[model samples]
Target: MNSPPHPPRQALPTHGTTLTPQAFRTLQAMALGGLLVLVLGWFYSPLRIWSNLLVVAYYLVTLALGGALFLALTYVTGAGWHVAFRRIPEAMASLVPKTGIAILVVLALRMNQYGWQLHAGAPEGTDAGTYWFKQLWLDPPFWMARAAIYVLLWSVLALSLVAFSRRQDRLNPQELPRAIGSMKWSVRLSALFLVVYSITFSLASVDWIMALEPMWFSTMWGVYQFAGMIQATLAAIVIVGLLLRRPGRLLYGIFRTDHLHDLGKLLLGFSCFWMYIWFSQFMLIWYTNIPEETSYYIARMHGPWGPVVLVSVLLNWIIPFFVLLPKPCKRSEHVMMKVAVVVLIGRWVDLTVMVFPSTVGKLPVLGIWEISGACCMIGIFGLLFFKALTKSAPAPKNDPYYGESLSYHCS
Candidate 1:
């Protein structure tokens, strides 16, 4: 007969069992209700509400991309660092599709905001000529099609990877082929998804955010948003990994100091990456001072929004530079939690900076409209994310890497 199940263990400095199902449901309901209020406020302030959702969708896309990319890199490089910690992030990724629908709602609202949907009947000769000439590549139909394709690709890859792992869990270890097959599909799909993500996200950036100032264009915008994704996804994984370390879950013995170190290191590395991309974007614009790029900067640099810029840079890069740069700090669980909190805050600021220049246009309103909408998304994301995570065994038990992961170490 099988032995007794492991007792639910406490996490961190506290002493309590793993999150009970009832408690989990209660927390989820609270968060979901909060998000509902935010979303409902959209009716009164569509631009404000939709813009925030647009940004949220942007981050969600990155989370899934990060997950798919991480899984692929883990498999291809055979990196042992992530094996113990992979599934938690992998599970967070499953939230991508549910949020994808939310994104589509935001996308639909954009067409109405800018009249991008009514392209065919321009007012006259040279104006129409110039408009179509510049925007032929930025048509609304193309954006919708590409966005759908991106979501479909992401959904297939993410769900398939998770489902395949679940299938393997029910079988004997000798059914290693099933797990290997899943890994192989995951790796291949991840590569394709990355390419598609780059193209589609760059295009979507133009359609959704950058197009808010259609005259202003930046080639590095896509990569810039991508950097935010890395930063946010890194924090997300760290947070979830820490949470799942409670006993009676898959991560108890699996998530070791080495795993935490690797996560901390990723947080540090991505912090630098985000800074590099942001500077690269600004440098080209500042040096050339072209009318298009200059306009984008002018909107942000000259007024109430300038402080937002400083906050974005400071939160996204500066604080982390100090917190994560020290070797000792990065390895500590407390410091790592601090790092996650700051990065998450920074990402919110970064998204605000990216869009407020166009939509709010120097308007700095922190009223219920923005607050309620954001609270809703946050609550909903928290609800769906943990819900999706707990549904499975919390980790892939029969995964081929399970043995290596359970005893993961740096030596």
Candidate 2:
């Protein structure tokens, strides 16, 4: 028998488009349901609701930052391989401003949820020095001011990057010189943003999450958060790339398996990095046997929290680490898709472990409230991301590296 002829290839769009109606409606329901849940959860359990919202806000912000940060890294290093799918990260970064608003709202309304805020000026006890320091370091106005600065700075830089990239997309082939200039500007801005993001994000982690237990401190907290952020980011990129590769999608034939394999490598590497940070933090605390330091772990590693911690490790590190180790797995879209989902879920679980123990109690709590809050954030993120994605070409055809990116392959 003669071999069957290949099916005709579908034409792809050169520019972005609106979300399908079904997608829009689905995201709409998720957002509405989340709002309803928040309202109901508020009445049912006030503190719990607030705590969940805090988790959602922080989680959303970090994910958005991860997108922008990923873009900055690619730009600074002159990585051309990502240019074909750059719009996805650009859309992700677009969420920074929106999430910034959510975070500010959470901080403003639920400022007292944090231990530092609650006991900022409480009567001094045995640890008078510590109390005094909390009073100074955790000052509410100062804290809010710093948060505002972070939001403003991050929003401006992230938006500028997106804006510049979009502008470059409008250029024609003959405008290559101008496109090169834009790329140069992107590199300079990316470098500045990287330095600024490093210091600000570290302080932000300390202020927002680490300050949850005022008496406990870990020097490794920032790096730990960074690892998780980048890991999830890589997984997210892989997921989006795979999704876009679906038939009739923007990246139908543009985003290839080679890109997927490289992304898998990143996912695997960062999964290991996340585990490293987790162990380093745990080992140092266990070794020192210091009350202040151990107190943080005591809450998390004991009681109902113990199992949750275990689950977090398995989901965040163990699963992704082994799943993507094989060369074939990385190139298989199905395998990579599932692993990416696991890593993203693991990220949420990790965040839950970090936020809840500090806010709720030693025992773990999961209910409609937490679920609803997450749904709301995810829904909003999808909507905003799609909106941003539609505002420009799905890929940068005018970038100097666009051709190189399209032909990118791993030996």
Candidate 3:
């Protein structure tokens, strides 16, 4: 059968746009308010402040990392439809350096809780060989070194790719030779980033999160972290895209219903993927009945934590799956935006469940510290993301696939 005809390419404005003054002021206020709130939390409860900071730091880092991963995946797959919306992910990825700094600050403040003291002494009755291995591997200095390496590698790769793309944007649109060469370099760097990310991100997850409960181990933990990361990243992209679609905005008219549909489909798929990983980890532990492993879930599944877990499942998977299952809903900006907001909240809840159980235990204290810390991170991330967005065009106008992306339509 013949392929469906491509829609006529739409004309986008030639000049690049920046965030409006009103929006900039709003974000500035949020940043300042969140900072003040965080300070209050710090003075009120240092432990809670640090714990929430850990959650915020890891969550923001994953979003930035996942944004880079999204770009790499699109390049590897040669996805033309994403070209028109590529700037959102690129800008999000640009926050990597900032996130790395935030993570380091959190670690420095809370080094005592993150496997530092445990390396000094081994558990009784454990084999000397195995104990030494844990001690060496989990040493604070080694952990810090690995984190620094991961951050440096990710920042360099992410910035390099964005720089290449931006350079092409600055060139004449007729400069196909240079643009194509730049695109090829982006693809090559993307491949390298993906390979490095697969290992380093897994180790980072184990170090930053799983190490909190050093006794608990799940073979699927890394993949589990990856699943949430992608889901959350997609949601952030969707939210930003919707915001940019408003009248008189830079991205207005660039993204249509089909783009929203594509994004919703991804959100739905990853929601299920995250749930599958969650269940797989849970089932294995429940089935094996291993005390070491089950203790992790028991802490989360019992007491006040149990309801939070159930709500997380509903918010992350059930709501998005059911809501986006319908074609019309996926295409509706209103519906998908709401679903994205819910999924984003669910992502935070999921992170809370993971971090708090190990740090705060069953007390279930959700107060100013949690609220203010989250606000602080969101404000900071928003500021960085918007600042980066202003540094380049809203879309890659010189991209080889620009026309194809503009003309994309579902069959």
Candidate 4:
């Protein structure tokens, strides 16, 4: 017999169902495929291998660092606009372990490609500035340790948040304070993480990209990486969100237009933020016309590097500027998705700009290694994301604002 209807519940959840077998299969394929590609690049070829390695390595780091930051921000601000999407960030955070592993592998492989890391380049002048110029902080062991430390810090925070979120799902509402407290600590941990993440990323830029020239340096390089990390991570978030909310599904409204609107605004914010840093770094160096500083852009302007520089600027700033400048476009999920794709590609090209100068040296040998390695990173992203899908309830069961998020609509 049917039971009588009861009073309406305020926060009933819809994500108790676990992952499907198909999802598991997909995850396995991605992990296996990514490893295969990475191994192929590592062994088969020399040309563009480092390029591929850089692309994959940076993204893995990008996802983890960005994941940690997103979770921390949600905790810091306590915004309900994100309730529907929080699970995915948790999912992204869960992938930090794999990212950590990938990054470690990338550093190991760099021994062959990166000469500066092994020893300081011989200076060629009367002064240390003239001689040691680029090698100041671009040496090997230090670069190696810093990269390792970045992942280590990121993993700790990631695991912490994922653990607490899982606890929140299993326990009663009264347990929220503990979870929230854990979240608060995650934010504090992230604050310290950001400082190190920044220095480390700069050192990485110096280690991986700046070392290519072994002469060029940009203080804003860290900010540039941070901007791309935010942009790319958001793109990853949107892509995952789009898939999760596809057609009919239990955890729907996770990628609503309003959410897309907020995401678009974030994309726009980072676009502008990148430009500010880009211009600030460029103008000061340009104004002074410092032989040391101006050389970096000069190489990027003349040959094959020229196209990458132009393409990067156009895609990251120009296209997004026009497409996202209007309120209408930001509110439309379709438009933002398109914009996000380009923004992501532009960033990859920006990495190319960073890598090609030293590694490829205008040869443009984007050979098998590069293609395969990029595919590998993509595959890893897929695998980790898929695996994460199974680990958590699709939605938080009793978040206070679940209803608000469910009914959230664009004005």
Q: Candidate 2, TM-score vs. the true structure?
A: 0.94
Residues 1-411 of candidate 3 have per-residue lDDT tens digits of 222232344555534355677877777787678778777778877777788888889999999988899999999888889888899999988889889888988887877687654655766543466566666777788888888998999999988878888887888756777888888889999999999999999998998999887656788999999999999999999998888866567777676666777888899999999999999999999999977678888898878899999999999999999998988888777898899999999999999999988888787778777877777777788889988887887878889998777776753
User: Pairs clashing in candidate 3?
Assistant: none
lDDT for 56 (candidate 3): 89
Those runs of model 3 whose alpha carbons end farther than 4 Å from true positions after fitting are 1-11, 15-20, 116-120, 124-129
lDDT at position 252, candidate 1: 59
Could you give the candidate ranking by lDDT, starting with the highest? 3, 2, 1, 4
Model 2 segments beyond 4 Å from truth?
Answer: 1-12, 15-19, 115-131
Candidate 2 overall lDDT versus native: 0.84
Cα displacement (angstroms), candidate 3, residue 5, comes to: 15
What lDDT does candidate 4 reach at residue 380? Answer: 69
- What 10-residue stretch in candidate 2 is worst by lDDT? 1-10
Question: Can you list the residue pairs that collide in candidate 4?
Answer: 117-140
Compose the digit string of candidate 2's lDDT tens values, residues 1-411: 221221223344554334568988999899889979898878887778888888888888988999999999999998998887898889889889989989999888877555544463554333666666676777788888999999999999999999999999677768878999998999999999999999999989888888887767889999999998999888888887777766666676677777787788889999999999999999999998977679888898878899989998999899988888888888888899999999988998998898888878877988888889888977877788777777777778788897787665664
lDDT, candidates in the order shown: 0.69, 0.84, 0.84, 0.69
C-alpha root-mean-square deviation, candidate 2: 3.2
Model 4 scores a TM of: 0.85
| Clashing residue pairs in candidate 2 (N, C-alpha, C atoms within 3 angstroms) | none
For all candidates, the clash counts are 3, 0, 0, 1
Mind sharing the TM-score for model 3?
0.94
- Cα-based lDDT at residue 220, candidate 3: 97
